[model samples]
Target: MKNKMTSHYAAKLLTASLLLLANYAFASDIVFICHKGNALNAKEIRTAYTAYFDEPKIVDNKALRPKLLQYLNMSEHQYKKMWEKQYFRRALTPPVVKKDDREVVDYVESHDAGVGYVAEVPHGADVEVCGK
Candidate 1:
């Protein structure tokens, strides 16, 4: 009986571990986004969202912006004010899509120039992960 109980607990532990791993695997991923027409870059992404720089250099046509607007119930201006306290002065372009993070991921995956925030661990080849 003791062995059986131990085995059951081990199996349950394994199952829990697998579920945790799967949760991580399927979590939403955020990415920086911009108009396909914009000539932004990754450094811009760090600057725009993080508010840690005056002028972040662009690399490879990407832009960095925050992904929490909808959740915060705020407009771009409010977001800017919060960031400006930290020193980001650049004008922010509107998000390419109006939908949520999942939608952003779908759009970013399909559009070559579409960049946005995502929570999923990027697989490369499809969307680029900015700001680590």
Candidate 2:
């Protein structure tokens, strides 16, 4: 009985921690990043990401996904629906999903037309900030 109670409390603590972490991530500032010479501004970045631009896009799934969606003025469900429609109707592939900011930066660095959002851009990476 004591063991079970301990485990239950532990689980509750973990769940609370995760919820707090998620809220922190959501509240954190995000930045739009692109290839070093890309000329996308904040407004253009919004349109490019929400619309079906030909340029490659990277999504950092950890801390930035929900925040980016919020910036794009959509929810996760809405974003998925949009991508699904694009994929099924127009055969447009969705943005590539990266594990974290580092991979997102790396992808944008290599692709001339790449764009992505991150919680924070790493130091010394050759990426341009489109907007915050």
The most accurate candidate by lDDT is 2
> Where in model 1 is the C-alpha error above 4 Å?
28-97, 100-114, 117-132
Clashing pairs counted in every model:
17, 0
Best by TM-score: 2
Instruction: Give the clash count for model 2.
Output: 0
Model 2 residue 32 distance off true place after TM-score fit, in angstroms = 0.8
RMSD to the hidden true structure, all candidates: 9.1, 7.0
| Residue 65, candidate 1: C-alpha displacement in angstroms | 14
TM-score of each: 0.36, 0.71
Per-residue accuracy of model 2 over 71-106 as CA lDDT, tens digit each = 666888898898888778767678888888898989
- Model 2 CA deviation exceeding 4 Å by range: 1-28, 56-60
Give the per-residue lDDT of model 1 (tens digit) for 37-106. Answer: 4435655654544444333322221222333443234566886576555443455333344344455656
Q: Give the range of the ten consecutive residues with the poorest summed lDDT in model 2.
A: 54-63
